[model samples]
Target: MEDGTPSLLDDKKRTSKIARLSLLSLFNRFGFALNSIALPLFALAIGQDEAFYGVMVAAAGYVQAIALFPAGTLSDRKGRGAAILFGGIVNGACLFYLPFVTDSLMIIIVYALTGVGSGFTRTSLDSLIADHTKKGNERTKSYGITIAVATLAASTGPFLAGFIIDPVAFPLAADPLFRYAILFYIMGSFRLAAGIFGFFTERWLHDNPDITPAIVEEAEEEPDDSQELNGNSRDDLITAILFGTSQAMMGISSGMVVPFLIPWIYAAFNPDPIILGSVPAVANLTLASGTLFVGLQSERVGKIKMIFLLYLLTPLLTIGMVYIPIFLVMVGFYVIRMAVANMARPASNSLFMGEISSERRARSLALTRVMWTFPRQTGTLLTSYLLSIGIMGGIVNFGRFFFPIAFMLYPVCVIPMYLAVRRNKRIVEQRRQQRELTDSVEVP
Candidate 1:
């Protein structure tokens, strides 16, 4: 009620709905993993270089950046379910077209279109999840369970895709390109299924009388407009901005490194397909574990504190991951760093979303994503350009240039969020003391 949504599902309804959404998201993530594992390799197979791959990824980000705000507004106005349904279909279709296209321009265009679908699905899904849960630990728990389940599938997808596509392993098709195409088709199928299931799931939730709009009216006889009219709206906006900026900084750091990891491995080590695939598989599995574990700890430790700690740890890990000469040791650092860096997300998201009104939640989330994606994409482009020109020496030097910058930025980014949390706590304490004084006066 405090978050400003029209309805809140009871515990029973909330549990059931969250379960359904998690399953749907699980399917989507699995499909996404398959493509993600294959796409860069597929590009490399097609004789394109790192710069081209960066351009390809950036194109999608660019389109996604453009679509995010409008998609958020659309979800706010129309319905979260509709946005999910539409996004699923559009995204699946775009992905389906990928294996067939050999032309570089067409590939970029189609891949870019997938961003539109992603924009709609991601914004709507987050909003829908937030809408269902109350602020604080409950929301964090929901996100943790959902991400854990979804990422469980994601962890497996890479291994499976690699097995099927690996010329040394299964080698279903004589042509490597054919193997990739087959993987793409399978990926598209799962994505399409996720969208269709999401639509039905939304319908099922709506049919629950307890979750209906009519029941929401009965639950709250009169709405309080004061929450919005008070200065809290200004504070909420400011908090949202700070949160977005922090994420953007994180994004810029990650964009340079995360997306390029597999590509970097391929270029530097020229490892086997299964080896290449295992990197992400191991990372995702750890990520799922880390996300769930950190989420559970977030409430106990305090959301802000948990976030700051994680932020501080990642920079140190990044440096180690960058410098360690041993391949497996470096990967160990990479995996741990990936887990450590991302562990704060559930806590971070819950804290920010808890403070924002439901009416403004989607837009605020979208704006935050835009801030993250734009800079992130720019970092990607910068890295690619540097790689293309041989400016950073080579791929090995990428970590040296980007990771240190990221290391510096990570600690700085947390400052704004820390300030916001302090301000919020202070205001809440003031309000509580004022209420106690008012009660004492009334009693006298």
Candidate 2:
């Protein structure tokens, strides 16, 4: 469009695009970090109790699960930019509405809307990145760096909310419900700002009409996406299903942790906003570090192998999560363990990317979410009820109830993942060796 042909960027547009995407992540995550502490406290304050908190969390996941695959498929057919832009708007509106919510039921509805927004937004971004890069090391590094930057930006969310909640800044800090509402207001404003970033980023992407976006100003024939008579398509499908199943196994444990961890910490330790914010700050910091490590190590270590090895650490961390006696130690354990378990996530995603064909990439990723949905949906509720009941003979909060049960359940998710990785790895190796042998024979 600038000179009668599609120029992906002309220095200025490139800078504009990068700046917007970076700021978009920073502001959006700042809002989410506020919710990390506020949502649970708000539920309890409204007299809904922990069980309702479970339902609130479940409601979001349910909506996300339902919306994910369809949204991905739609984006592939339509355009990734529209999906991302719409998602940011929906999330911003939902967060803005959070400040006004008083009734528990209304809160649950907002949570669901945000969940739908998350599904569309996440799928679009993942697909967008894949569209921009070919299947290889470039894709791996791009995914890793993107996640690392966002997580690092989000690390400040808890601290910002915590500082605002400090009695030094706000008078309502003493009243739990009012304080939570104020935090929601601040975070919502940031989310609204994030919507602006998404809008600009979407507009700029219109200039570069490649695999990343379905909206091309030029009229061209679309590639046939059919799988009939395509051998590689069948192989890719098999690998995709296998990879998705394994990722779901890993997701179940993490899903259970997010909704209830702060509440658990409050019940077991203290309710200070400083404590609530600080813990997540540490977790996000470590996640950023872990993602960076994967990006740096991708070429040195095989992505699939690194992913498998990193996941092997899950059971150990989850086990330690339940048995740790001191709150500080438990928090430290949570940070390290989470980092260890997720350090290779970018690599795992890259592995998935390498296996699937371009046409089905987004939906394939969504299918992975679907695989994890039921287990996580059930796990969150089950853990919440179990936590409510306490342990045998009235002893739950001590050390043997909420987390240990999840530790015991961790294997159920990862075992299938291990098998899937092993099978996929073997297949890949066989293909490589056969190709090398054929190449040698052809040369002679």
Candidate 3:
């Protein structure tokens, strides 16, 4: 088939699927942002400390990591669409129940359930996208577009939630708990809609003749053991572990900012929720814009090089956050940081998908997610306790201290990432050489 020619699915059908996927991303992110905006405040409202909030979030992360691999395995065996739809429904149900529960333990239970749903939906959705696209550029575009849409939705969600929950503006709407509850209710409805849409969409691979079930089955059965044979000597399993550990570390770094940022801003400057929402909104918008650039230029830039460059810049951005004394400056620094951070995401994802075999892709992706979430939650829990002890009493002083520590750790983190990338590159080259040798022998 020509590159520009439409598949048997037709242009309209393909477009529809993409649209549904985009909407699904949007809704999922909306729910995520809503929870991010509300959860810490919910803990405060229930008279729980910051440490409790951290623990709650961490529990959710742990659950998500645990569920991700199993969910991916199921999606591989069953259908991706069914797995995603089922997960979405479960997520919606959890959100619906979230508002009604006041007990901390109950809240933790609900969050953990949501994490399970998250694992199912996200893992399946990514795999489905991979299954649909044959071209590398197209896959990158798809991921970039999906992330951009999610960022836009996330930006909107927090702003709306903040406006609704702001005590001064709404006066009567000052009930933070009720406002948060309503936001979750809306998010649940969004999830239900996405789930229904997912249920009706046609199978991604079925429409393409080039992607025969027999071919996929064959690929799955013949596990690629080239990595094991090559003197390259580095195990992908070990690399994956290192990658996951780095992700956990990054998550911890992020946790230091997220759960505390709003409350810190509130305590120091007493800004309204709307103003508080602006910080993340700005960050999300920047991220979206950066992703759009990546989508347009990805084919030209070469994925790995672009990702490496972006990754190197991230720690500097994090350190920059420490120097800004004013709130607006901090927001600006954060926006820049997020933009740089997101610029690397699509490339990293493409690298990951390209490196792994079809059968192992799901588990590999799950492993990455586990690393990302688990460490973040652990970091959040620890940071909350530290913050509770009045460690970060002053903004400038705290930033000066923590930023340098984070900066010092950045190079250490980069070493693992660099090694992994090199190892993957070598593996790809080895695979290419082996394929050529086999093809040459077969031609005789």
List per-candidate RMSD values in Å. 5.7, 6.5, 5.5
Write down the TM-score of every candidate: 0.88, 0.80, 0.83
By summed lDDT, the worst window of 10 consecutive residues in model 3 runs over: 212-221
Model 2 Cα shift for residue 14 (angstroms) = 7.4
Clashing pairs in 1: none
True lDDT of residue 45, candidate 2: 69
Worst 10 residues of 2 by lDDT: 222-231
Candidate 3 runs further than 4 Å off: 1-9, 171-175, 202-239, 392-400, 407-418, 431-444
Whole-model Cα lDDT per candidate? 0.78, 0.67, 0.68
Candidate 1's C-alpha runs over 4 A off are 1-15, 209-233, 427-444
lDDT of 2: 0.67
Give lDDT tens digits, candidate 2, residues 1-444. 668444554444544544455565666667677767667766766786666888878788888888897778777887776777677777777877876777767888987788887787777777766666545565676667767888898887776666666566555468766677677677666666665665566566666644332212234443222111122656656666776676565456655665676776776666477667788789889999889889667756877567666766665775676577688888887788667766676777766665667777888778887777656776677666665675343222523454544544444544554565566556666766887899999995
Model 1: per-residue Cα lDDT over 1-444, one tens digit each? 666453333645655776787898797788788755687788888998877888888888889889998988888888787888888888889877888898989988998888888888888888877776656566787777788889877898888777877888985589988888788788777877777877777678667746421111123332232122133567777877888888788778878877777777676677788887887789889999889887677888988778878878887887787777778997898788878887777888777777677888888889888998998899888888888988767777776567656666776788778877677766766776887899999995
lDDT of 3 at 306: 76
Ranking of predictions according to lDDT: 1, 3, 2
Backbone clash numbers for all candidates listed? 0, 0, 0
